[model samples]
Target chain A: MNKPLAAIAAFAGLVFLGSGAWMLAGHFRAQDAVLVEIVQDGKVLYTVDLASEEDRSIRIEGADSWNLVTVRGGEIFMEEAGCPDQTCVKMGVLRAENLPIVCLPNKLVIRFADSQEVS
Target chain B: MKLTTRRLTELALLTAAALIIFVIELRIPDLVPIPGVKLGLANIITVYAVFRYKPEETALIVLCRILLGSMFAGRPSAILYSAAGAALCLIGMLAVRRFIPPKWIWLCSVLGAIFHNTGQILAAMVLMKTAVIVSYIPVLLFTGCIAGAFTGLCAQMLVARIDRKPPA
Candidate 1:
């Protein structure tokens, strides 16, 4: 193999392995008793505990469309949306610390809130 | 560009193969809720095109593939994001092609990934009209590295195989 090719291959290998390890660590980490809030336009729209809430559904409407949000046993997700790309809905649920349940068209954010830790 | 029968056939075959891979990849269940994240198996064909074809020709192939692939997968709305990402990726890889030799194909792939993510974020920013979505940039960047490397390796193996064959 050519020297530059070999070097790139080595670098790729390192990146793949490193990311795999990072994901594994993230997957195994303990789940915290978190509070998730969906906010829009400076208003708190919906709030739920990620640990104790049962499976339920809610709908939020935008200027042009609406989104069906689901809350199952505390975890929140977008079940369906009327937006052009149902990307937020395709994203099943909010699980990771940094990953928020986001609806771009609606400007709605369902993420783990720091304020919930005390309550 | 003049389209010879032989080149046309080659393009069709490559398109068919890419579609097959795209369909097969769709069967794999998603592990995360993020809409953009995937193994990006179709990129294998893209990586090959970047090295083997002219920049314009490679772009045509990608555009056709992504358009048809999204239709086949029944995700019409996804075409925008895919188009944006593909456009950026194609530009970046084509530029890198000048500096990086075939040996460093993986570097080109990685750069393509970075550009792809940049394009997607740009779209998101425009559609959502806020910078808050920028938070996803780091995670996408991190994943881009891994996905780019895998696709690059696949392309490398493919180039080696093709090089071994005598030109017809």
Candidate 2:
């Protein structure tokens, strides 16, 4: 009801609503993504054109861990991960543009890249 | 400032309560697979301690909870992120404690949560040697705000109902 409380509430609401919208927008935009980039510790380890790739499993190994990145029918996901948390594995798929499949412990990331020429 | 018997006892009790919450929360399935998003239900005690106790005492309570909580959760590797977030959250909450009125406990908690997420991401960046972790900050911020509000409200109610004035 007061000024400070109202201001706090407005700020919180703006962040909550605005980011949610942005994330959702990103999700829809990713549906059109055809290039998936694999980066490790900030370097582009590999880039695959999802539209052209046949069903295959790529095993990515880091310092002391590994992630079995699988591509099936043009959809990419972390089918298996050696990290303790398995967060990236549980992430299911790389379907969102902004929300990358990040295995923090392994310094691994699978994200939708800009090249969208899916044939 | 003096660590009287009653004060020591209260701090211990609060730390124990927070550890319990932390352990219980560790059992809850992650709502999202995002690294930084969680209920963070244990933060309820930190928020309550920030308002009810002195800064020094609050720090002790948070330190004990984080250390013990990590042990109980069986994630020793998590101690770094948890400690960084708790330190930042405690400092920010203590600094802002003077301005925020009792009714805006949720706001204070929200700020704490933002700082917590920032610290976690920063730690990740340094430890992982990659800026890609920054991508999670927005989602963490948004989720942190909601979770903070819930825990803060719970703390606010608990603070109001149970009256224990600190010694002057």
Candidate 3:
């Protein structure tokens, strides 16, 4: 292998190995419970409890758009969205501590937050 | 600029082949829901193009296929992401073309894959208006390696076979 090729191969290998380790750690370790707040245009539109939320669904609407959020077994996700991409809906659910539910067009974010911050 | 009829025909056949693979891959259930975990079966045609066609021709073919493929799949929103990734991947592979021997085609493919992910992440950050999406970068990088390596190896085999056969 040439110098550049070797460098790229090494970089790719590091990325693969690093992510694998992160995922494995995520699997075995317990994640801290956090609160998720959905804000739209500077307003607190929705608040979800990551640890205690029940299997339920909620709808949030914007000027000309809407998204259906579903929480099942304490996990929150976007079941449907009016956006063209539907990326958030396709994302299914927010399980990984590192991965957050996001809708670009709507500027919506559903992520884990520290529970202690509220108290 | 006019392309020979034979070259155009070859391009058409390759385009069709790429689309077929793209559609077939869609039928396969998604193993991950992170919005980017894919085997990228269509990249086989890209790998073939890298070896057989000129860089400009290869780029044109990829652009047409991605646009038409997205429209056919009824996922117009995917155009941005696909186009971004394709452009980056194409450029990266084309640049590496001069250095890497035919045997190291997989290396070029891997580079292309990494750039593809980088482009997608950049687009995601802009669209979502947040750097939070960067967290997914590592996972995408990991998957890109596997998919790139797979497609690269396939392309290497294809090139070897075609090179063995004399011009028809």
Docking class of 3: acceptable
Considering lDDT, which of the candidate structures 2 and 3 is the better prediction for this target? 2
Instruction: Give every collision pair in model 2.
Output: none
- By TM-score, the best candidate is 2
When sorted by TM-score, best at the front, the candidate numbers are 2, 3, 1
Candidate achieving higher DockQ, 1 or 3: 3
Error (Å) of candidate 2 at residue B117 is: 1.9
User: Candidates ranked by DockQ, best first?
Assistant: 2, 3, 1
Model 3: how far is B109 from its true place, Å? 1.3
- Lowest summed-lDDT stretch of 10 residues in model 3 chain A? A110-119
What is the alpha-carbon lDDT of model 1 when measured against the actual structure? 0.75
What clash pairs does model 1 have?
A5-B103, A55-A73, A91-B33
- Candidate 1: segments with Cα more than 4 A from true spot: A1-56, A61-66, A72-75, A79-97, A103-109, A112-119, B164-168
Query: What would the TM-scores of all predictions be?
Result: 0.74, 0.88, 0.85
lDDT of 3 by residue, A1-119 (tens): 78877777787677778877776775666766557766554445777876777788888886646888888876788999997657778887676656777775566777765353644
Off by over 4 Å in 2: A1-10, A114-119
Give per-residue CA lDDT, model 2, range A1-119, as digits (tens): 66756776677688778767766665566267789988887888888888888999989888868889899998989999875667788889787777888876667888887676655
Give the lDDT of residue B54 in candidate 2: 88
Separately for all candidates shown, the number of backbone clashes (residues 3 or more apart, or on different chains) is: 3, 0, 1
Off by over 4 Å in 3: A25-29, A39-45, A51-55, A61-66, A81-92, A102-108, A114-116, B164-168
